[model samples]
Target: MSPTILAAILSVGVSAIATEVDSPQTQASIAVPANPDNETFAPLTPIAQIPDNSGDSSDKILEQINHYSNEPNALDQVTNVSQLRDVSPGDWAYEALRSLVERYGCIAGYPDGTYRGNRAMTRYEFAAGLNACLQQIERLIAGTNGVDGGDLETLQRLIQEFEAELATLGARVDNLEGRVAFLEDNQFSTTTKLSGEVIFGLAGVAAGEDVNGDDIDNVTIFGHRTRLELNTSFTGEDVLRTRLQAEGLGSLTEQTITPEGDLFFAGATDSDVVVDALLYDFPLGENTRVVLDANAGASDDFASTVNPFLDGDGGSGALSRFGTRHSIYYYLDGAGIGINHAFGDKLELSAGYLASEAADPGDDTGIFNGPYGALAQILFKPSDRLNIGLTYIHAYNRDTDTGSQLSNFRSFTEDAIGNAVPTSSNSYGVELSWQLSDRFALGGWVGYTQTTTLSTLGGQIDRGDLDIWNWAVSLAFPDLGKEGNVAGILVGMEPKVTDSSVNIPGIDTEDEDTSLHIEAFYQYQLTDNIAITPGIIWLTAPDHDNDNEDIVIGAIRTTFSF
Candidate 1:
């Protein structure tokens, strides 16, 4: 008979197509990047996640072919599924499908030879394939001496048998095509995905003392921080992230004269928007990923902070910055580059360098001449439930951004020794996380830094050394009250000067005695796009000095994400 009718009549056509066609891919779904430390916030939920395909599917003969193809992901969709001889049925189906593809150009699989992996095959796709076959046959019929009587009869019979299905499929195809067109015309940007977060907090000092030995005022204030991120991917594997941030949340530590209670969500920008982060990230080879920072890029952007569940880039994680991870990480900030390489699944190495004045070209204001931090970390995952990391940072004039002034004042001993002497430090840290169960997790870190006076302006004080230390442990309860809720408790010591040969002239000379930090927070996810957290932080000795009055802070924060 006719070539068109003959192909379908053969046992190969319906069965082979069903069995060989890779799962029809979904043109409907869009990809969202990763977590807060990566790109978008709120792990894979509604606005922060890819949408689901709404296509109707079934196990009918044609659908069976699609089922096999859908297993491979978008990245694997381009893989060539050429003539595979290892499986006899696969080999036969490949040859048969290839013939129909070349002869009629029907169901043109993929240009790269992979069947339309996971891209759903709609009635439109089927009708297009069918039309190609019918059109080719029509051209042949119009040719001289095209078909014999037997062939003509066979084709007519087959057409009469499937006429109803053909018409229905054609009408459905037209409708679907129109809908797809309208969506394409109305959808958001083809290359970029948008995500955003807004946090409103009512925070204040419940009790405390100022460093000047004055009773701290119990002032309460309401503030906010907002972030909007546009993540664009030129290539499937790389992403360029641009973030807009605005914050006016004031810190409770300002009233206590200690940095221990600095709220993670607080930033005193007075509601002024800024391009807070601009980073371009791409895969280097197979295992390495490189991050280029054009603006505010922190070490955790690429490097593993090793604190899971509680490492939400200060937006969704701990209430205080010190509870997020080891305070040593505070040194790795500013505009810089970060690189991560995976040795395998179990181990990874991350390194980076950041300079506060990288964008400045004025005298003594260039990258290397300004405050900077160089960091290296090795992370080991012994099991799915356990992770350990060892980190080191060599920095010049880098402050412990989240701790007390003894830790925060790294730029100079100028305030203390009267001379603006430069300082450098070497910081070491160890981090660990263990998942005790699906609901319980424990994480903590310890950091130590040795600071050395680099030079003196007037040689008024002998250049000596200072030793600083900080430690913390956190326990997390996941899905505590609800499926998306978390209850966290953290206890730690803020960065304090344990010893210093070089002395300060006016201040407490050094933070004396041990200061304990106790914090607890419960995050209740009200909806996929919203969460509320009420937390309390208590500092027994503000600024690590026992003489200072104890500080207690409370905050209720609400976050909306999209």
Candidate 2:
């Protein structure tokens, strides 16, 4: 018999008698020899004993092999026995193959759809079939469907073992969701934000020699100031700021000084709330901006003040206004409009007009009627650490005194005979600041003003031209003791009557003496939004006369912000 026919007959016999074995001895009993031609077919020994000469049987086996090889193997692709064209319900392996194909999607059929179960087979064919079945079993074990009772039990056991880890992951996801909801619900406004600050101050002043050389007793006072600001932005490049403030601190008792020694937090002594500032600023182009100030202060529209450490009102700087900036900045204190244009990042031009009574229509009041101050300034920043400003101001009837001894020109010109004087003045100033290191800086400004009396009523009393000058140097230590802390020292002459030729016949019209103002302060940051500052100011020869006793001002201020 041909080897190919013998192999086909043995394959059919093996399939016909195949059984699930539980022991090695049972598997060995049905195992086919590796080479069927050389070794006897052990599994088929009991089934039939082949005759030495059996040509007729060999011819029958060859014909069967040829027929099976030519037929299709429908079980290779069909999902069910009913889809097969030739397999019958009586086939021995029909139920097993159907179960595998339908449950695991492992089977594929030939194009003709016939199950050629009588085909000869090789060991390679057996390996390919086993591989497909094993892969299908793995898919059933991993997924949620088409699993038997044993597989379902195994998946449940795995889920129970990892229950704690799964619960932790779910809880983390829930926490993130809650945080997002809270942020969305509690946000303030889409285009605007509200912020506030409250300052409480304990201040005391020891009066120096009065005008008559009498010693005045020391006075102590407590005061509070609160400010609420709303910052709104329509476009990303513009800002609208509205601020409301209330304060109740009376004026200082000692009044002979030029700047009046007003508390930094002093405002309406009756504790009435007022709109302190209303300003809208928008970009004109890439390098220019226009500012509309319904009510603006002198410091509102200026660039850097040269003395940064002494500029803040109640929080982190000098307690006295005289120590903050040059007296020339005191020329304007009410409503105004301004513009700022930058030439690259190093230079800027700023100009503004402010009228003290811009909102009043009474005599000597109104936007352009009377009592206005106009200013123009050119600010230059040559490097990251240096800044300079050249400023000029034309003021009408605006007080120049800011509680500093050198600012007596304004007091001398206005408070002469207890009547307001119609005066026009022109002021020129130069301010500069240099950062010497990461934590130390030096700043100073020199200002000159020429006042012209315009009232005819003061015919020869105090009418003429007056020349006033003031200069100061400031040293600042930023982050002195810790981050956000500052220490500052100011030494300067307040507005001084440099040369006066007032034609007052019966009164002394010449001012030949100049006084020195020395101030020191340290600010300590208690928290991100809170600070405490302790400051002291000493004036030698106050009121432009060495005969006056030295004046001392001390204050402790606490500020809270949100």
Tens digits of lDDT, candidate 2, 338-451: 888899989989888888888898987898987888888898999989999999999988766553332344455445555555778999999988989989999999998888
State the lDDT of candidate 1 residue by residue for 51-170, as single tens digits: 222232322523432333353433222122243222132232344444443443333233233443223333323333344356555765697735455545544543454444445445
Assess the local accuracy of residue 448 in candidate 2 as a C-alpha lDDT between 0 and 100: 88
> Model 1: how far is 195 from its true place, Å?
1.7
RMSD versus native structure for model 2: 24.5
Candidate 1 segments exceeding 4 Å error? 1-69, 73-83, 87-179, 411-420, 505-508
Least accurate 10 contiguous residues by lDDT in model 1: 27-36
Best by lDDT: 1
Pick out the ten consecutive residues of candidate 2 with the lowest summed lDDT: 21-30
User: Which parts of model 2 have CA positions greater than 4 angstroms off?
Assistant: 1-180, 253-257, 260-262, 403-414, 458-462
